[model samples]
Target: MAIGKLFIGRKVRELRLEHDATQSQFAERLGISLSYLNQIENNQRPVSAAVLLALADKYGLDIAELSTGETDRLMSALTEALGDPLFESYSPTLQELKLIAQNAPGFARALVSCHQAYRRNSEQLASLDDRLGRAAALEATPYDEVRDFFHYVDNYVQELDTTAEALALKLGLQGGDGQPILTDYLDSQFSVRVVHGPSAMNAVRRYDPAGRVLTLNPYAPAETRTFQMAVQVAQLYASEAVENIVRQAGFRSEEAGEVCRIGLHNYFAGALLMPYQGFLKTARDLRHDIELLAARFGTSLEQVCHRLSTLQRPGMKGIPIFFARIDRAGNITKRHSATKLQFARFGAACPLWNAHQAFETPGRFIRQLAETPDGARYLCLATHVSKGVGGFRTQRSSHALALGCEISYASAFVYADDLNVTDKSAFEPIGISCRICERSNCASRAVPPLRRSISVDHNVRETTPYQLS
Candidate 1:
């Protein structure tokens, strides 16, 4: 296989600017002429091996950062944004999009942000018309605000993860028996008693601060009980830290702030449960096996998958994966990505995703070599997870959990063991949503693509109702 030339002139210029050095000075440091450096900065020339070595030698730069997956993420976002009906007439080439993403990342991100805001406003107006003035204000929803915050930060909060790890260490939550350690920590530190409450309480965990009593529903699974206890511990001991982080988020509304605070507390709880170093090592040793890791850590499968997505701690990073939880109606209730895959913010996910099929096949794992419309490939794993109340008359909530990473990391996943990742025929084509999908011949498309005109021929009906014109 031939290696492609690396055109990271924009990254070079970014590094130069970060060091506050002019082009001439930086070029001199790299032992290159000012004219040559200018050519590279403008992306007229590829970054040579000599320049790469010079960059490392002089600046001590991690050359890997030059190709950090940010450009791919930006390109995907830009492509989705440009797929809007408003940009139907303009179709830029892939090279042009790549150039824009690499050389003008801020502009690319701003375009994505603007498109998101437009979509939010459009949805609000549509809902308002349907409800006939039900809402009193046209403000951003709390979910949208918090989702945007995490999206902007690439779904990783470094300070919070660090604090949680330190807290875990202080409480001696290293290897064995997480639940007991947590229970003892609560009792010893806060004088709180941990007790199992009746199933009729209809809550997983409830804490009475005044009485210093924490109760967990006995019907809940052991993993759920332990997680609830961890969450309560975070609330009692890490409230100030969580509040400080939430304050720094600069949320627009008090409701959003509170919601974000609760979210951060949950994040701290997960981090404390699965401390980064131990979890990463275990994941690697298990070949990223979800069930084995879950049993080893005494956590649920969903918890292990979610924790894997958050293993993005600077130099000690794990495989970048996207995690999503979807209900039977195909509504995505929880979503985060450390990869280029982003979920549709307002609607259900693509029907072709294996996650939806997981609901039909309970207690079975669905493995897929899936490709998005952007041509990116991933090894997708999905399974159904059900949470039920103990009694017969009580309700149960069933959801499908999806976890995946780019195909380049397929070797690290146990689910990909029997598959040949390089075989193009094995990959199933999927999309983020039908409205934004560009596939013209999709049989399951419920809606016409926004960027393409639809032709409805009365005489000739295809797999889909309409043909792309």
Candidate 2:
């Protein structure tokens, strides 16, 4: 019979240090030789079953739990990092990665983090060039700066989240819909009367601080009204927290700060309307049916999607999902991800993406299984949302929203129920955007990839004008 080494040397050493015990003292206590104890602590020898029991008896330690699938997770992350084209020429073997994961987990984690940061910066650079047509990001606009801020943060603002969660509890959002509770809160707290009617200047929400009147657009749906009321509450009550965040952000322009402040207010509103813990529980319970979630929380589909993306609390994380809204023109207006999939920052999204197709089939969900150029597969869901002025004269505001996650998480979503997720051929090939897309034969590519050599044979007709080399 053979017992494998735990590879939890650092953990054992840490526990010993916590108890202020030397190797000899720990060895004496565990009834093992000092050299054996040293070998175990250095991951050079197996931690015997007897020694494990002794450590538990002596130190109240769960040493076996220390190595519970950590090495596997680390290896998986390392493998994905190596799968990047940047490491293609010099990627270490899988055995080396596994050894690093087992013996030097901390170093392995640090390497993964560094690679992520490097990749993020590179994407930002490419995005800056795409959006602003400039080399330096200093020239970026307020919207650009704010979008990047949220993108880097994984779209979760913790302080604001806590504040909103507390507010949701105080307002009793979990037990009921957001409308009545939020309206009563505004009335009692600020002496503000919530009047639903056509607001001045066709605004969705207008708060007159002096008059203490909150007017909402009558044409807007009940969900919109409730959400705007929450936003007003945030503006009224969560002003300090919002300002603190804006100040700490150190945005280059006051305009960016203002934009960020409004964005925070909206974020607080979403969190308040659908409090994190409650929303997460319900989402999981309902298997993340967007319509069901929307009905439960009294929020719009887009709101639910956006809130789901922010369910990234430290210990109680929801599915890591990417959410975005795109206009008919193919512009990604709002984008955030708690997953590996990021939206194209510079231009319109890929033409073949489900979000674009959403505009064609309004009021119905469009599900897609797609693979990016980086070999990442996702289960994408898209639908269009329309906000009409209740008449034909005024234009109707509509946009397509998309929610997605990697194929590994597809089973958890109701939208993926009928998808041929296991079949590679069923997944359509897609990209972030054509300019940065490395796919050589994308039929929908509008522009050539950046920093890549391409061949243009005018005589030979291909899917794209330029062939990626």
Candidate 3:
């Protein structure tokens, strides 16, 4: 293999560039010389265990992600992108391009960035064109805005979680067995009637303050119910507190602030459902099994997953886990985590995870072992969840979520012990890193890593180039 075509090296160079570090500056940080760094990027040197460890500890990059070059993800993205009609002219030459991706790292990055810029610009242009005024029409409903806000925060806010916890304790609503579902608690304790009915409109959840009642469909999944309760709780108890946080955060727009307020409400509802200690105990006893937890609490898998992520209480923390729900089309609809996974800031996720695969095996829980660029491995459990539309359309849809943690903690839980296969090696290893993975060797990757170069030369296209940056 030609030198300067290494994924790890390319990543090192990108990070060095991002920090604006001269080779010497980066070398100093790694406690290595410029020559050693050069050797690593050039594929002349293998990444050392010491340096890998340092990257994890010092830079906060997951060690497993760094080492394994989760190529499945990269190739998947590229394949999807290449499938577009815009790329049809070059479709016949994809094999050549893939080879370039493996052999010439610089060109691979340039292409990825170029494609990203193109997509962004196209979206902006499409928005501006606004043929049917769809943007404005959707804006009339707060749905898109709220979704965007929650999506922006990845559905978990540490500050809000803390506030909810304090409030739950102060209100004597923090017990495990005693805690009731939000609607039930409201109706039984506060004389509020909680029921399920068709929304007069498309309102996901609504509270009738005048009627002193709350209504959500029995068909609603655990997540929907939890959200409803949160909305109701926010309307009833923490509206003022939510406003305070919004103001403190300096959100100038009233719309944005209101969205935060609603989110805070849901956060409280989740806390109420899963009181820190009570829920944590059950979760541990249950070995953090999601389906069992959902059944026990009358919540959905997503709700259980969300609660699991929030077990980040200072003294009583569960294993750090990442939760993501994606539709069949690969759009990540909801995501939250306290783990080391880095979601791509602006693009789709890797396609190989069970999150997407769950579509094929609906109602079945699938397990996968995923590695990040820094060589961190996690055992993931994924399942599909659905919701119903009550009225005329009577439409139904479903999505999938993957719940995972580092493999070291797998044996500690029942979910880990039941992967359908006893041998860990029998399970396949997958990855999620999009930018810096150097596994030119993988066939399942959607797109090659941005760190690899392209090879236009004849007879010697190295598998996705990891050029010495």
Candidate 4:
């Protein structure tokens, strides 16, 4: 028997085929000789960093996938599958397994898929346990802590939107790129200039009454501009009003109150740019085309998702979408959702979701159907967006945002209409539950969840310890 090579020739070849480009065309586009490109594709030559970057920039391959393969993604699935404390002893080996991913790419991918199956089973078991006292314990985790925080903050978003819209209306700043003009309005009306400086440089978009000119960093997004404007409005125009709201929240500390105050100010700013009624109308009209909505409202992709999550106004609520921002390593940094979908408290998400795939085709929209252990399915859509904290000359990183909902709500999204949804079986089944699945037949399980009991039948051996009938 021959040992298989670790080279990624097939994937490279597949990329070219997927884009419908000939070898010569790909070689020319990559600025490499046809023979050399052929050699690289054949695994005769390894791809260099320059070539890898070119491929990523040209073909839009996810940098993480191009570099780490699926090791990180697999690690996430494995971590979730090992929800049981019994696997704690194998943690070091798991770390080593990740390093091995660089050398054994095929094995890494296989582990990811296998781990996904294990997670599904664990989640199933967890669902059964949800009826017990476990529900309270589950609700008290760090994950729910943040989620409840966001839920409370969402109400603040609604109030701020209403107030900010009224303010924007009064100022007669309804359309066009309003940042500069809004800055000017603040300088003229409030006797303060907005100045931008490094976090260490004293102020981040600060108002300087002495300078008399609002100096904004070019790195700020349109939404940031609006946010800054709203902060200024709260400080100057609605200081008493903002204070009043904070007072009602009954925070134990001044710091918490201040944090909530600043957050509310930001909510107000988003509303100024995208007033609730108008933004929701456009979102519905465009069928939730994020790019179109971003352009029409002069906001960022994140801002659009954030706004979408807030369309939960009783009978007029839009199809609830959960928003999560994750890096290439599958680490979710920020999350907001109107739907019941709960993000992983700690560890990586399912590799099958569109969010994970967004890293592959940077700018394009990808959609998929995801299933939880409870047999709940959702339609997910994800895309990548980039932002900078400095000018064009400064370094910037790209981030991905994934938004999705239950499959029943698919008819409300334009992205769902464009997907191949006729074959329900073909749609990948995924889960948000990390510890309750009972598909004990999976080999990729890192650890059995704490709730499952292992049954031993020496004469009748099973693939996994736990059995669900």
RMSD of each: 24.0, 23.8, 20.8, 16.7
Position 234, candidate 4: lDDT: 64
What TM-score does candidate 4 reach?
A: 0.62
Collision count of model 4? 18
Q: Which candidate leads in lDDT?
A: 1
Name the runs in model 4 displaced over 4 angstroms: 1-147, 152-156, 173-175, 194-204, 209-213, 221-223, 252-254, 391-398, 436-446, 454-469
Residue-wise C-alpha lDDT for candidate 4, range 1-469, written one tens digit per residue: 2222334555678899999999999999989899988887766676776777788899987755554435466566556545544354565466455444544557766765776665454545444443331432233234343344555454334556677778777776564566776777777788776656453122236555565555555456756666666567666766666777778766555656766667666666677777777777888889888888888877778878877877776667777778888888877777766666666544566554678778789889888776666667788888988766565576667778999887777777888886655567856766553354444555545455446766666667566554544
Candidate 2, 1-469: lDDT as tens digits: 3346565666778889999999898889989999988887776776878887898999998654765477888899999887765675887887687568877888999989998767656665766554444434432568878987787677899999988999888767883466787788889988999887666437778888899999888877788888889899899899998999999888988999999988999999999988889899999999999999998888889899999989888998999988998888887889887766666665679888888888889989999999987799999999999986455676787899999999999999998887788899999998887767788777877877765778889898877776787
Candidate numbers, best lDDT first, in rank order: 1, 2, 4, 3
Deviation of model 3 at 371, angstroms: 2.5
Query: Candidate 3 overall Cα lDDT vs. reference?
Result: 0.64
Candidate 3 ranges beyond 4 A from true positions: 1-115, 118-204, 218-227, 418-429, 457-469
Residue 418's lDDT within candidate 3 is: 55
Model 3 poorest 10 in a row by lDDT: 132-141
- For candidate 3, write residues 125-219 as lDDT tens digits: 43343322232222322434554455445455666676666656655654333325455557766678866676523555666778886766655
Ten contiguous residues with the weakest lDDT in model 1: 130-139
